[model samples]
Target: MATLNKGILGGFSGKVGTVVGANWRGLDIIRSRPKNAKRNPTEKQLEQQMKFKLAVSFLQPLKTIQSMYFGSGSGVKSRVNMAVSYTINEAIQVVVGLPELIYNKVLITRGELTSFQNAVLTTQPGGVLHLEWEDNSTQGNAAPADLVSIVCYCEELKNWEIFEGIVMRSDLMADVTLPAYCLGKTMEVYAFLNNVKQTAASTSFYLGQHLVN
Candidate 1:
């Protein structure tokens, strides 16, 4: 019997009439199937696989947002792929509870929103969210009168509170009182500055989650 070697498109397979295909590590090629016996994966290996699966499932829904905010390359497809890879890797690290995974939120793509300096969020005793930032409008593209938009998400209740079009960079600070139901739960906060025309916005910054105080 004669054996033929095909290109990467042909994956490995058992010999059939002297032709076979095989794929390895994403490369498709022609090869004969190995005769080694298969063994069950170790517990650690299975756990890692589960973590990767969970990470993918959690990040699938955010693909649009990722592409919109994280797209950086000259080509759309490359930008999207980079964003997906970033999100997936972040999710996997977080799922595995890595000690370095201190930030639970996804990394925000830096953009026009970089004008604001030292944005901070704090929870007041009365369950009020106090957002403050140093206005660097003169140094950056944003104007002092640019609109500020804030979003708060309560993870436990799956509730969202949005405060938009009511604050400006000139104000330097804003306060948002949480509803009674949102008290005692952890919430994630995001903030961004938008142009006066409302046609453009800076990158949304994750201000970290806080337990309602």
Candidate 2:
């Protein structure tokens, strides 16, 4: 119950007489070890701890992306706090819809299409993916040459397949061949466009998930 101010022993580690020294929150302190409690944690308390552990494990890998888009000039601690809060509030089972960070601008995460319209996906023989979309080049934000980026995730394999290429705005269709192993496994697809000249990117569109056939 005593706060050891710095000027005292200047942070002693190990046991010194009856006092044990340690560092906590960047501060040096000394305290006596308390006796272990006899009662175990309740079920609800254990569940809460499990949720926290899950959140940390889930968000650890996305540290780079979260810092890129949601840092907001704050340190990594801020982003971690946000991710933890979101995970707890929503009880997120799968991680998706992370916002894209481009040219210091944050774009929407939910993948709402704008310049591209009527996107459709169909599975062809041999597990080929046929993607078709209407070209709305007349949109003010549209450009003559844009880069299309597609990301698909195979939950069964815990793998992500990315495809990106420069395409003329007039083109309305594209195709991708799923790996033989990915056939018949449900996969989620997301598509977005990047205007390289302007260094801007469009909001991603979630094309939904289905078996590749």
Candidate 3:
């Protein structure tokens, strides 16, 4: 009988191929020695089952080793590493939150206010709420603090309500601290972006950073 060599065994990798070879060998044994075979069909079936089961049992440890590289072995570790990389990248999202507004009817167009050319809304703490664009001259041509209007909004009794108004330029960014009081068990809290200009003015909300909690 030609023995299974190290080179041939390497190809098994503890998959279906290992059982296939064992099944073939068991069939050959039965065919070559039929006179002293098991008495019934069920016994012959059991013999075949035992052959495959023994093959699997012998390869179980090798299966564990191979699976660690390709499958579930290090899923948690890889995910943790990815989370750490994101934290190190400092890709956090920040927003200045809604501006202050006394009335709900007023609207501020993104075109009229020219300091911060772009605005991003986010859910991070201690992050910049606003940014401004400047010409290459490094000279600021912005209006006074009283001239810039920030329209703010808050939720009241399940309705969008206008809050106070503020005159601000670059110095009026507000940090929305985490709510100190928990009202009750709730799925989500509601807030609104009031007085957002409809024409040529747009604000984008997105997932900025991937961080580990």
Candidate 4:
């Protein structure tokens, strides 16, 4: 910080280049902008950053689905934000000094809608995924018109296949045809149900990893 007598630029009172000019007690004052402090993050902060990175990377692929099906999306936080918060707090685990996402605990959707019952997933030859579930749609609050959505992630190939409303809950079964590139890759599969009106969704079910045939 320095005091300026205004020799040439008659009473400058704003920022110009690297210095800031202002009037202070009938005197022009010039001060350099404060430099940003670059400090190493603490151990806790580093762990949190790692966890956030892992959560975001896994959820980013299903961002669109999350925005529509994660929670109620009625509070101060958006559905995507809710999903990220839930993932960081509930779905991530620390192993070997680094954060890793737990596949079975990770949820792609959440709501009051009824989810799958006795769901079974198997792969047929040529990259076909066969999903079978009990027809519990007529029970309780479940509706036959509930839409089924599937998500497949291939970590080795870094590929995603997201299918929304491909089948109905009453259908009891679904077949997801994967792309040719996913034929040889092992895939982590998940399924969820949302109402036909798209107002709510059930918690996603992890169908486990399957070696594509």
Name the lDDT value of residue 211 in candidate 3. Answer: 15
Best by TM-score: 4
- Give all TM-scores, in the order shown: 0.57, 0.57, 0.22, 0.82
Worst 10 residues of 3 by lDDT: 185-194
Q: List the global CA lDDT of all models.
A: 0.65, 0.61, 0.27, 0.88
lDDT of 1 at 169: 89
25-128: candidate 4 lDDT, tens digit per residue: 98767798677799999998999999988888888988999899898889799999999999999989899898977778888898889899999999999889
Model 4, residue 89: C-alpha shift (Å): 1.5
With a 3 Å backbone cut-off (N, CA, C), the pairs that clash in candidate 3 are 96-129, 99-151, 99-152, 100-150, 100-152, 101-152
List model 3 lDDT by residue over 1-213, tens digit each.
Answer: 333434664322222322322235433211222244555668546544544443333223323222322122245544223322222222222224212222222212212223343333333433212322223122233333322222222223222111222323333343333232212211111111112221121111121221111
Question: What lDDT, from 0 to 1, does candidate 1 have?
Answer: 0.65
**Descending-TM-score candidate ranking:** 4, 1, 2, 3
User: lDDT of model 3 at residue 57?
Assistant: 35
